[model samples]
Target chain A: MQNETADFEITLRPNTGWMQLDLKEIWSYRDLLFLLVWRDFVAKYKQTVLGPLWFIVQPLMMSVVFTVIFGNVAKLSTDGLPKMLFYLCGQLGWTYFAQNFNSNSATLVNNAGLFSKVYFPRLVVPLSSLISNLFTFCIQAATFLAFFAYYKYFLHTEGLRMDWRAVFLPLLVLQSAALSLGLGLLMSALTAKYRDLVHLSPLLIQLWMYATPVIIPLSEFPEKWRWVVALNPMTSIVESFRLMLLGAGTVEPLYLGLSVIFTLVVLVIGVLLFGKVEKTFVDTV
Target chain B: MSRPAIEVRNISKSYDLGSIGATSLKDELERLWKKVRGREVSARKGQFKALDDISFDVQPGQIVGIIGRNGAGKSTLLKILSHITEPTSGEIVLRGRVSSLLEVGMGFHPDLTGRENIFLNGAILGMKKAEIREKLDEIIAFAEVEKFIDTPVKRYSSGMYVRLAFAVAAHMEPEILILDEVLAVGDARFQEKCLKKIRAVAGGGRTVLMVSHNMSAVRSLCDHACVLHQGRLIQTGDPEECTETYLGIYHPTTESGVVDFKKPENETAWMKRARLYCDGQLGTQLEMGKPLSVEIDFESETEMEPGIGIVINGPEGAKILHASTRNAPSPSFRQPVKGGTIRCDFGEIPFTAGRYTLSFWFGGLSYDTHAEDPCFSFEVIERDLWGCARPYQAAHSILWWPAKFELQG
Candidate 1:
């Protein structure tokens, strides 16, 4: 026997491959992913004493931590904006990207039993994870919006300042998702090969948080070292969300445009790599 | 193989087991550096060839069983056929829809109910959504979980889980079905039903390729069998012939009708000897509804009372008859019985011919007396039936009926 794949010229019958990631099939299975997401959501809250309130409780707690550690303690300026809103904008972007990335990256390993026994484009697992993460991100975003509304009218401050830039916020959220999907797919493909990626991923994601402008504003960086921060793909994503939602900073068209281009490029390449790897990942995984 | 549905040509798979077993980060990193640049990279360490130069064809509407021991590459073959793992070399041309039941409930999410999972699992098995919708009721009915169809499958028993999984896979009606030891789940009764469903699926005229250690299942369902020993093809022919070959190849000491028992022989007030015969033939078939005799040779080394009897267990694990010589009035021959042979002949044999065993007791052991069963064995051949109402009783639980059968999906 040799180490070569046999692609016997089977009759060109239309199969799942022919279906070619048909969006219609995906739409039909959308319920499956929805239920899985709901299951995860419910299971998370089920035993927790706080229940679904944890969704609201989590970000609020994180907001307090950021306000103390970055705002009061470090005296990090939020571009003269309320510390809560400033961090909330960054938190939304960071939460969406990180949650989607972690879940999607582990999709293959998480369903290793299923993949070895059954055949479904293997892409479905990660895609399903992406959907669920989207749901979680939505919940968190809605909570943040509630906070934003309350701060705007009820608090009675310039904190209510309006900016037309917020309308592009959806695109920013979408870009974060695309970035996550790309990186997640790439890591998933690699993790199947190097299982060490399983242990390495979370630490890397945490370290990556520091590299991106997640906890602190990109403005706080030393002028000499700003270029490096600007180079991180997530740096622009975080900055874009802050600019769009908080209206605290001006958009660097070059950086934002570059982030968008990178997102599209990585998305295409990630999908291709994902497809190619899924063809025989069972062996390595 | 006629009009091959799945053809595997010159396929092989090799697995590299790195020097260290999988461990946590601390252990892996310590070894990763050593494993990467170490001399253990070649002959002494890395590769183990799981399958080598394996090739076979599964014809459309043909049921082929691949029989092998634990590591003789059965799984590797199924994996390649399903494209879950690509073959190391060569090519496989799959002609129709290929559904592999290598593991049941493979993609089922515990969060989903049986209804939702049927659709998800159907898609994973290669059925389109509309097709799954059409088969939903059939699947639910076949699984016999209608009451719990809308409830989460996590609440289902393991038997129910596999049943639902099998139902979904079967409903797909794939042109080809590849199963890998997935039938060992669920209750025995459910297993029987699953076999029936598989037969029905095959009756639909599609190809099936199965790998199972259970020789009975292979013999009952497969039209053709391929034997694999130590990662090489040993034989391919009728299921019975292939199984015999595979068994002989693996255990050289094994002989026809001679079970390899390790205990030393003993004959003490025990029916130490027994044999099954029909029409004075040895180790041969018996006709159903014919007079038959079971001879038991025992030793009354101690002494016997009125409760001593013989037990003849028929095929299908049925205890068909018990004849006792103990109850007979004391000695018509005017000789006290000690060690002697007793013969029991039935005016009519109710058993269908296949295989059965005989055992006896010095007293009513069924009601608590002393008796030892050497685990005797026997086979009942199909009654040579000619024309009208032959009174044929099948000795087996499930009949192969000798048809070249294939199960698709």
Candidate 2:
């Protein structure tokens, strides 16, 4: 028995500094992360009428409404791209970011019961949210592709060519995930202590969507005010998506570079804050 | 010497007595403003120490019980050990994989089927996916919910839910397992099975730390125990002595053999005082097989046929003896009268060494007037009733019965 104590597997202390991410611990709990993601995906469609079809139906409806209200009624510009295709691409990108952020922001409060009783990497919650929402984004993206192929190949619509730069779709998606996860981690940490953020989050996300090129093309905004959209960190990713897919939106290299840098910064700050808060959130939450 | 499986070094936890943090931005801004102005901030004024400078060590393969009254820091200490909450000061070193069952079915989603929950719950308890797959059949059979495995747990009866949850947790093989009174769930038969499972886990050279209010469970299951009182480790050693100390702390007695009840403000019947005596001397510690008597002094408003009764309960709250004046073959004070004093004497008591509580009640044929259940507590010390000149093992049985054996061949 004495020889058995040669290795101390874990040491728990009063404070582990703010920057100890413990990514190795998170990797060890990858199974739980997978199960949590599976749970979120499987549980959402349990009793729904259409099941996962709602994933496709949701963005489809949003695009139709945007094309009708913004394109026909409000008469917003879609550059040279078709209104439906323009809105669908924007909706798909924005939905991925919005959904991830929404779920991740509530991670701590919603799972407080489970969190208080178990010992697992708290970051697993937001990471799993990112993965599960990716599945929704995929389904919605497939729907958008069907419309894209119909307009480009089937109808031979004018100026509807897919550029080689469309290969950056995955990178854009990763950026969206990172940005949302970072913001979500920051919000979750804050909301655990000050729940006022809970009520403020939805409004924040809504106002944030208006500032991005979700319903209208960035080309439609005034040149002087375009930099305001560029500052959102999401604008460049959305514009890049439209640029590569529809070949209409602008992709300023400097703005895109700034967006990536800003995302990494938010993500670092978010991770640090989350790591600090997860240790004692059970007490305060 | 090998190192202890767990070394807790002066672990302490504190919390703000008021709100943990300002719930709104307005209040937070106000606090910041005060801090900026160098004014006193009230947030730091109310600090509560849940656990204070507590330390202990657990050896591998040892089953240790942590016993304490409510608000005694038992849960707080377990939370810190399990890493569910961080301690404000001090540290701990654990030599192996540690898993804590702070709650059963903690991560189970109601919408998920029982089968899915087993995997989910198993993963949450730190079992690898492959490990859970290996134990899936055993877990299902143990829970006896094979028929409902595919059904959503929301449809499970609470019994089935708990059974399934415990089954998943039981299969988790960790080097150090922390349990928090989770065995109190389920029926008696299931509880017995869970206890057996835990015992088997410790038998496999693993360490177990459990917090239980059930003293009998602690005594029977734990080889070593620690008694916590108000965030301090008051006692730690043999489970029997630790349990005794825990009971004493919970039910502190003033003096020894006498208990004085507060005088009732306006009552028809009330007990003023009660006393226990052994061998005509007032004492709470009674030797085994020694004669003891209880005396109660009371005053009543009515002159009716009053019946008085005394109940003696063993450490586990099991009734050891119940004597009633109404049941006496030849009743003293047969004539109905206002209460004054009543004494009941008995032959040698056969109770084994343990803490026992005494309760008294006074009533009439038509209606019971007043009763003080568990009015006071006393102890029964071991004595050689058989004249064998050897110490009796009191842990196995609650009673001592004298019997004669002769070699007739």
Candidate 3:
């Protein structure tokens, strides 16, 4: 008789961290994540009357509000650039960070139906949300670029200057994304227990926005207050925006360096907490 | 010996009970204060045991069946094995790639088409996008949804939706396949097709672990069955023996009668009484395949013409057969003695050994004239040697009857 046998024995280990993320198995399933992202984007506009146009409309309208409130009414300096361009850039950047964080924070809760019923990386939910948010970022960024060129040519002025530090834009984006993802992973884990994160989120976002230098320039502060403003990681990001794009401000190397350290620490803590929580979260979340 | 595909060792899972009694906002504040002071809190909290020290081994190519009721920790075990959730205490060693189809369409988005969701569901199941793309044609063909592959799944029929979902899962060939009751969807034929594929996968020296409540399905598909009850592993052995033990524990009775109908009787509009009035007699007992007529004696309290329907179901609420007399015209509306013995003749019985229930629905008369659950009782046994009932006619041929039949020409 011919006997056929299994090739290997099954073994269970604690967890596997591949690609610096939770749910490596889900990372293996990233095609599905891309599909889910496509689905999210399509579903958002599928039945809506305005469709993809709503993408540009949201940031465009936010820029209008910020230009009026901060530029004309409060008379905040736009670093010698057009108020619309300055406000629009800040809005786009802030929106990317906000959406990524908010969506990641909501990962477990929003996809509870799926998470409870199936076995996959729970992190996949938030990761897909980040990907979909990327769609919104691209749309807003393209709109801003068109306006930047129009203003530069029509106004007969270099409305937005270019600096070599612009090559490091990806690092700034990575920092912002990493910070939000870390905080989001942390908050999602906390949400399983407290169940009050949903109520506290908007309030937290308002306070966090004030902490960020989205509406104000970094140079406006006194040397002493600069330390406080630069304590926020985004102050380095926004300041770098002015330094690299408009040459109106200088980068805070000390503050930006601290922000990087803080980002790494937050991410490590987020992963540890999330790992601990995913093991037992089925009963709670 | 072949290497074992899955090894589970001393896995125990428990969940703490939530707060006792009604908790007001003030009580919550007081509780928080007590915690801050580091004082002794009440130890009246309870814990629910979902799985208690379950240990099992699945050798390569073994198709293992897990049979249990709801909250039996079947799903919990599957999650732990699939790594969706971790075991609280115990450890599991699994060999080769594992795919779990705990729920179909687990990550499906309503806006995406069948084509889009196929890739999405595949990826979630641990298949690469390129692999999914390569198998896209086969997946679409198996799902039989090529025509509407581009239509959003939200617009597809529930059958199509399940078919596409199952197809994606089927195409992702993992060394070990863990399925949790997803076969309950799709038609019987497609279910058979899926079962065949599972057998093929197992036959190819791969492992398959299935958690199912369908006793017959377990009997047919699993070489070995493990019974679980109330978070404890009760028994494990051959499929027939384990199922006998399981059914013995599950369907116990004081009267020693196999059938039990503790079904809550509906007080609203009903047939008054429904039972088999077969072979010119009215009896509570019945013989298998007995050309029986279910006589329903109903009376409409008010003058109304309502559509009457009957659905036959099993213990776990799976509808076996459902038909409605809604199309039949009742001309005697607004009259006395309007109801009679509505006899529906069945040539043969299609059931094996199991207790069954009867539920009737009265609809289309008024908004309030719906009989939600009119549960009653019936039974089927091994057939007799004498021909009592005619063959049950299908579109093609007669299904198998348990007993032998002699034809008198």
lDDT of 1 by residue, B5-109 (tens): 877777777777663233345555656677877734234356777888877777778888999877998988888788776766677888776678888876677
Instruction: Please give the lDDT score for candidate 2.
Output: 0.87
- Candidate 3's TM-score reads 0.78
TM-score of each: 0.72, 0.84, 0.78
Docking class of 1: incorrect
DockQ each candidate and list the results: 0.22, 0.48, 0.37
Interface RMSD of each: 7.8, 2.4, 5.0
lDDT (tens digit, per residue) of candidate 1 on A1-285: 111212223432112342234466456555555545655665455436877666667777888899999899998888777888888777888887888889878877777777878765566666666766676677778887887788887886585565787787777878888888888988877777667888788888889988888777788788788878887788888887777677766357787778789899888777777766676666665
Question: Candidate 3 has which clashing residue pairs, if any?
Answer: A10-B93, A10-B94, A10-B95, A11-B93, A11-B94, A12-B93
Worst 10 contiguous positions by lDDT, candidate 1 chain A: A1-10
Give the winner by DockQ: 2
> lDDT tens string, model 2, A1-285?
434634747889987677769888899999999999999888998998899999988788888998899999999888878989999999887989999899999989999989889998889889998999989988988998899999988889988888898887999999999999999999998998888899999999999999999876788888999898888899998888888888888779999999999999999999999889888888886
Q: In candidate 1, which residue ranges exceed 4 Å CA deviation?
A: A1-53, A261-280, B1-3, B17-46, B250-394, B397-409
Per-chain TM-score (chain B), model 3: 0.68
Residue pairs of candidate 2 with colliding backbone atoms: A2-B2
| Total backbone collisions for each predicted model | 13, 1, 6
* Model 3 misplaced stretches (Cα beyond 4 Å): A1-10, A13-27, A41-53, A158-160, B19-30, B37-40, B255-409
